[model samples]
Target: MEKLCPRFEKAMGLISTRWVGLILFDLLKGTKRFSEMEADLPISGRLLSDRLKMLEKEGIVKRNIYSEFPVRIEYSLSDKGNELEPVIKAIQFWADEHIPPEETDDTDEQRV
Candidate 1:
């Protein structure tokens, strides 16, 4: 783990950032509006906007703004971004089995 050089470390760092994981997680579902992301994620507007732009620049997300009405915009995963779905699912499975029920707030509820 520590053996990873700074370059890889920085690349991986973006994915592991506080809100980026959840941000990407939700975006993986489908195209989402800025407001939709803001509501679902516990991130500040500026930070979320910044991160989305970063992801777009990284070629992980595609942002499209519509020309109709008040103007609509949405974010969706690119081909490369879709590749991370399996990794996210694996992480979820690992957490479910390894993380203690008491450690998470939803443990009291029935799980799928």
Candidate 2:
């Protein structure tokens, strides 16, 4: 077996976490407020917050705070995050090729 490179391992460790990819992918569509992200992802608010912090630390996402009555905050992809577009697209392509479509009750279906 081949040994994994530490840098590669560390990079994977960050992105491989549950909900991280989905969060990144959602941000790819455009900037979104905290509430908007929560509504789109099925993850808990706490988890989403944690993941956003983590991604922010990694320079993959940007958080903007607006001074308003309630203090609005928006999240968007940083340049680094935008660089992951091809990577995400490749994963999406692979899934599309390998995974079978699920049988669901709703007409609107979503895939990661």
Candidate 3:
């Protein structure tokens, strides 16, 4: 048997994490603040923060901070992260074809 490519394995490891893929998928819409994502995703605040930090470190997500009375922060995909749109869309297409409606949370469908 042949071993998997390290790059591919690492990518899968990162994206396959719980809520990571969903986070990316959500970002496909556009830039969003932490509060926005927290409201949109079912993931906990701590986990979302952790994943955002990880993605930023990996250069897949970009974080912007605003200087103001109260600082504002927003998250957007980096060039590399935007490159994942196709893959995420493909997965969504596949899931739509194969997964039964009952298997997925109906609320998510409404949200999208």
In the predicted model 2, the residue pairs found to clash are: none
Q: How would you encode candidate 3's per-residue C-alpha lDDT over 13-89 as one tens digit per residue?
A: 99998788989988999999999999888878999999999999999999999997699999999999999999999
lDDT of each: 0.83, 0.89, 0.91
For model 1, the superposed segments whose C-alpha errors exceed 4 Å read 5-8, 105-112
Worst lDDT window (10 residues) for model 1? 103-112
Local accuracy of candidate 2 as per-residue lDDT tens digits, 1-112: 9999999999888889888998999999999999999988878899999999999999999999999989999999999999999999999898778777764322342366
Q: Return whichever of 2 and 3 wins on lDDT.
A: 3
Winner by TM-score: 3
Q: Please, what is the TM-score per model? A: 0.82, 0.89, 0.92
lDDT of residue 17 for candidate 1? 72
The pairs that clash in candidate 3 are none
The top-ranked prediction according to lDDT is 3
What TM value does model 2 have? 0.89
Worst 10 residues of 3 by lDDT: 103-112
